[model samples]
Target: MALLAYRDKHILSAQQLRKLSEHKYSCFSASLLDPLLQPWWNWLVSQTPLWLAPNLITIVGLILNVVTTLILICYSPNGVEAPPRWTCLLCALGLFIYQSLDSIDGKQARRTNTSSPLGELFDHGCDSISTVFVALSACISCQLGHYPNWLFFQCFCAIALFYCAHWQTYVSGTMRFGRIDVTEAQFSIIAIHLVSAALGPEIWLTKIPIVGLSWNYTILVFITFGYTLNIINFLKMFTEGGSGKNGSSVAVSIASTSRNNEAKNNYETCMKT
Candidate 1:
């Protein structure tokens, strides 16, 4: 099953690596991640011969995601005057751990011949839960204390991102975010949220100085604008990005022929003097 491998050696191109966060698999949503995980995939491929049998990275990530979600829920920022900094730190760490391992397990599979459709499904299934929890916690924390509008927008934006991701995959056979996709945006968002979690909600919140409106809420309005616009841009690409070609054998044949010509150009470049 090349689709599901023993050692998950990803085939991600360089540009995709930088924007892995925006990368999406469309169908499996996360399963398509194989093409965007190069260095981590490479590491797992290196372990192919021995077939390392440590606990699965996806399992570890799932556990951490759950742990973080639980702590955030049980000790919500709204409920407590201040949840323990340690608890907040741990929650942030849990998400971070999830982020890193999220990229690691597929490579492990491809490297070790452990890639299974089941594994791919499991990996993504857990990620869906992770997204839900992370968004919920962040919103609850902000809403409980000071930034209600921001919380509203954050939660809405996060869900919007996921929904758009699903839509892109269904329509294009490509999981995209803005001009990017899940592969390009995932790690970057993780970094952004993790830093926010560490700083506590106030740092970004203070950016607001509205005469009447709370600046936090104002920020959310703008964030909403950005989020909605990107989703729209992604949709627009469907209509405008590719040349409009209907279902025609000749058109497809021409397109296929063009692809070959482009490939030939690439090959010649590789062989150039």
Candidate 2:
């Protein structure tokens, strides 16, 4: 079947096409920072030229983010050594710009009357790639590579949580976000970069006298707890089943039913003729 698909010219199946046509973007984010940033996003979109395409804006932001992160990686490839203070600042700025632009792209599409399912796909595709870079950059900034296993765990955990978020969306047909979510996490990383820039990455090596733990380790512990909670939440949601009829995954079940109904109608029409 895999080889047969490779031989075929078309990628998407008829049912996939039907699902795409019927697709409606549904997202629910109770993010702590999104509401606060809405006004800023609205103003940014207003200033954006009508001639500028939404996709172009998204791509530019993603490129800037990747390039800045790559520069940091080049300086500290092993993640054990701290990159230059300026590089951390540059990375923070790059991430901020990317976050701002990402928030406004959908608004730009709606403003231009050019919204489509493809736009959503493109936006999420960029985000999925960005998650890895962001995690790596954060780890490097904190010099987490000194503990190689921890560094690997942090990066892969980030990627896994991102994937699981989309998987939840696939099942429930609605993207759900908690109060302290992506925006909050991005800002926290930006703060980490800024702190590294000002006080130097060595600051994270400072041990808390009472706790006898380095700042880096303390933060990592907190982040680990957050990841554990997220995994538990995802597992609970998965086991509870989706909100769709008969406890089925919403999008897949709806698409399957629609395709079946369409085929039945076609057969009935042929019989009448």
Candidate 3:
């Protein structure tokens, strides 16, 4: 009976299916390293059964991230002592699993022929919360909590950068995850965790004499630069006539049009399959 209800819920009319098929619902993101990993991802997606729901995968990923975050918080470094270096490895394992699961959820949706705008929204919303968990865990793993208020700042920067990227996507009708995207960022975080496990978290806290910046701050600088570049890209799109509309009136029109079009396209695409 439950299976019957599930099937009924996803069933779509022919006209609705056609509209979905013609609509372009998927986001367009260019990541420098994605191509290299595509084959592995494809294989994993193929192995996932269509009976499983994509949102369930997303929830599982979120749960893993949440557990990691809780562990990091418990292990947060004190001025006198650091978390057991081995715990960093645990964090890394959780992050890797979270990223892998996150990647596959979309594939699951596509496989099940149940992709929809709501699914995209649900995926992205979970991503936002996951971003916070990742940032906090990374900061703690790196011993950045030793510096007062710095950990909060790191979390804020991570969330703000992600929000900025999404905002650009909304306005420009194009999604650019940046030259260095979330996937790359997650891998970098994983690497940091491994390094901390090997060399100790103090390694990240040590300041370079010449630059007067620690490893943590230096990474933050790079993140800031990437978000700044995202902003520039958005401005470029606007000045160069994004959405192919022009003049002062274009701003209002494009804003509403792009949003509606994106939602409509995603809805159609999801239902079409």
Candidate that scores best on lDDT: 2
List the lowest-lDDT window of 10 residues for candidate 3: 241-250
TM-scores of all candidate predictions against the true structure: 0.58, 0.93, 0.76
Candidate 2 residue runs with Cα over 4 Å from true position: 1-9, 13-15, 266-273
Residue ranges of candidate 3 with Cα displaced over 4 Å:
1-24, 77-81, 209-212, 235-241, 247-273
- lDDT per residue for candidate 3 within 128-177, as digits (tens), equals 99998898888888777666576677778788877866665555555666
Q: Model 2 Cα RMSD, Å?
A: 2.3
Candidate 3's TM-score: 0.76
Could you tell me the lDDT of residue 216 within candidate 1?
41
All candidates in order of lDDT, best leading: 2, 3, 1
* Best candidate, TM-score: 2
Greater-TM-score candidate between 1 and 3: 3
lDDT of 2 by residue, 1-273 (tens): 988878675688776786687778898999989999999999999999999999999999999999999999999999878899999999999999999999999999999998889899999999998999999989999889888999999999999999999888878888899998899999999999999999998889899999999999999999999999999998877767587767668865786778789999999999999
Between candidates 2 and 3, name the one with more favorable TM-score: 2
Can you tell me which runs of candidate 1 are displaced by over 4 Å?
1-55, 77-81, 141-153, 177-215, 237-273
Worst 10 residues of 2 by lDDT: 239-248
